[model samples]
Target: MPERFPGCITRVRGISAGHFTDTRRPTGCSVVIARPGAVGGVDVRGAAPGTRETDLLAPANTVSVVHAVLLSGGSAWGLDAAGGVMRWLHGQGLGLDAGSPETPARVPIVPAAVLFDLHVGADPARQPPVCPDAAAGYAACQASLERGALAEGNVGAGAGATVGKMFGMGCAMKGGIGAASVTLDGVTVGALVAVNALGDVRDAQGRLLAGARTADGAALRDTARALLAGEPPAALLAGRNTTIGVIATDAALDKAGACRLATAGHDGLARAINPVHTCADGDTLFALATGQAPAPGPGLNVLAALAAEAVARACVNAVRAAASVQAGALWLPACAQELPVAP
Candidate 1:
């Protein structure tokens, strides 16, 4: 059996996670709530990302902390979910002081990123496109406070996620959410990712975990090999795919350190997913430091390295935990359904 960490982002102090899955369609949103606030930073690698409040996460920005981070599956429209998170935080009186004596108020800072799952499991005849809204975000925030541990696969933002789309949806496989954590020198670093890439996911040994399928959908096509063999890239829907996630730590890191950590998190994606950061994919990562551990002297680099490993493990866990989805004429298979482990 492969090595398993069995750890999640919620293990980090001051962090909580939750999900709100819509039953009408396979679409939903996920929330990572940081009580009080945490120093935040972000890195966007994909060319076609849809995000909100990312500019404020820059190291030079005046606002140094964020209240929460949201990941949703409604494409650009999913960003609205962040507003609901903000509302919830405001109700709890958790945010930056932005008002005076007469109108004292706290403004919650919630940065968000989105993935494209709009084309999956929708009935155009029955209703309009099923996308997550502010209500979904509010519900997710409530779930975070109620559910202590994070749940993975086929839930939240990853509910309708798919991967290995180099040949389009017909040959793609189901993707979902995953989480992992690692402890180093008394500090805990964790990651939670939604795997909705435009390429195949691989194991540490470069073995295909889940990806594009054969024409008959009986086996993996080794998407990288096919493209290297002169297969023309399919005309996939523009900006219709992405992999977004958050990395949380209890280490005492400043805004600049947090930004660097976010960049390092992308290394895990490159290691586990082939052909990442493409024009059609929107890959974004956010980092939060709750400052519960001792300030790093030279151990920051090592901490970042652990974050990368956790991210890679989380990527594998995403697909491995996913269950296949079949909606009338549409069928998206999961790693377990199509590639079972040997008993």
Candidate 2:
């Protein structure tokens, strides 16, 4: 967190993590809406995806200020959890018809994404179906908001996140949600990333900060180098990765500008991730304006640039805040240890 990024709007109210797979594995991360909804846009760069409600964010859509954002494991099946969020938001009366009496109705539009975390090698027949704990986590976030306190690390959507999947899960490292904020001029831009990429993790300088070795200290192969040699093998074709994130700013943006800002924010992902936005990876970025503060500049390009830079800082901070963990036999190192934080 930097002094430049401080602001009264767009505060992270609460964070909740839980396990929602019948596999009894951790794979839930839920973020509650702390700020009033503003304009929203989404940019999906990956070929294979398990996304929910991305179309609603398009410029043609009518909804704004989604009640919640869900990031979880269980692949495409996890999209069902949004129903729970909708039910909760309906209860809060935070939907579109907050005060409309003529046609009072509620729609707690929620956008969600999922990562592939099937119990590989285990009995597929014995594995349980997707659970509703992700929704429970959302409820917990709402509760945490009332009580106060937001926990970080290996929780929520980061529960099953792993990085460096170029050689597959056996060689990947554990990853989780990472947050970073930066202040430029007088506005604050904040980023929260659910890091589950299929490539090696790096810092702003492009160094291989982490995920180059195996859990047992064995040297790992470089997926980037392999791609240069030839096409990826069939075994690596699984939808094993994606990185989902949200960029929050007080600056106002129209639908097109917000979309452009979301695309520009990909630079931050490129800066922090090697071989991003691949066919097997569904990398998406969402630009959100809470309307608490107005865009400082008169032009959309300037505001877009600011949003992009903020996104980049957030991506960098995410890698910096990630913790090292051992999944199965893989030993992932903490981002803080791999790349020292700036002074």
Candidate 3:
């Protein structure tokens, strides 16, 4: 059967996403484009983070909307992808109205972040480290703009991604992109996450799905357990992971409410991924509202709860959809590859 696109995020009118992958380079990006602009806010919880245009979303900032959000690999170098997104939106005449006087103009507003995936993927001596740049970002935007057809796993920002590096790549498992959404009384909430963390992925039932493996390549081990064990080798891996995502909703909301939703989304991360929000992990979540659907009578809290659940589900979906690959000398099996994890 063909792959199914998770349509949760796209369910929100005016919101669309595109995934562009460069298989040869083995690195890419995910672009979430909002029609014109959508009310937006973000929360960065991880100690080490790489982001751009987030200041514009501050509660006191003048810009209340964002045209797009970019999540990419290549650490800070991947931030360049937002430039391409801006260029694309500009050509479509979408952006903040800054030009005055005679000529009508619009300056696109794009917020973006990055995750580090250079530790492996290709042989260092042969392929050279790969990262997404302006050209690559522009190309992804050009591929599609309409809603639906959401891509997950080994693609976009999740490409060249890995997780559970607590014991280094040898025992680390593969991580990728995932998405989920929910609808309540006409209000729709959804999430899309790039699962690259220094922890393990778990299902709602608290079952260990994927993460660090036994040294002999046997069973999966809880990342936190390995660290608590105080093994001498556990100190080898430091500050080399991140999990970034976007929370989308159709309900009307202001920047403050959006920020709250972003903050609440982290609770889902904590439940789904063990040992999150670490100094080595740049776990950030962005929330956007299109203002088309009616806000619940109880306010944004209702939507926020839905958003949290959606994020937790998306994290698991990311790992399940991931495909195993040979990253240079490192080999990351599929979430179900030769392992006893249920897919």
The model with the greatest TM-score is: 1
Q: What is the C-alpha lDDT profile of model 2 across 1-343, one tens digit per residue?
A: 2221222113522222222223355566555453345567778887777888889888877765555566666677666666766676667666666546786676766777776655322234564654435465455445534533333446666666777777556656666666665555555556667777887666555556545344343554455665677846336775778887776665666776667777877877887787788888888787776545533633556666655666555555555555676545545665555433211
Please, what is the TM-score per model?
0.95, 0.81, 0.93
The TM-score of candidate 3 is 0.93
In model 3, the Cα lDDT at residue 105 comes to: 77
* Candidate number with greatest lDDT: 1
Q: For candidate 3, write residues 78-132 as lDDT tens digits.
A: 8888899899989988899987779877889989988888875655676436788
How far in Å is the alpha carbon of 220 misplaced in model 3? 0.3
| Per-model CA lDDT versus the true structure | 0.89, 0.61, 0.82
For model 2, the stretches where C-alpha displacement exceeds 4 angstroms are: 1-23, 32-34, 98-103, 119-125, 130-134, 143-150, 212-216, 219-222, 229-234, 294-299, 329-343
Steric overlap count per candidate: 0, 6, 0
Compared with the true structure, the alpha-carbon lDDT of candidate 1 equals 0.89
lDDT (Cα, tens digit) per residue for candidate 1, span 176-265 = 999999887778999999999999998878878899887778788888888988988789766899999999999888899999899999
Sort all candidates by lDDT, best to worst. Answer: 1, 3, 2
In candidate 2, position 261 carries an lDDT of 70
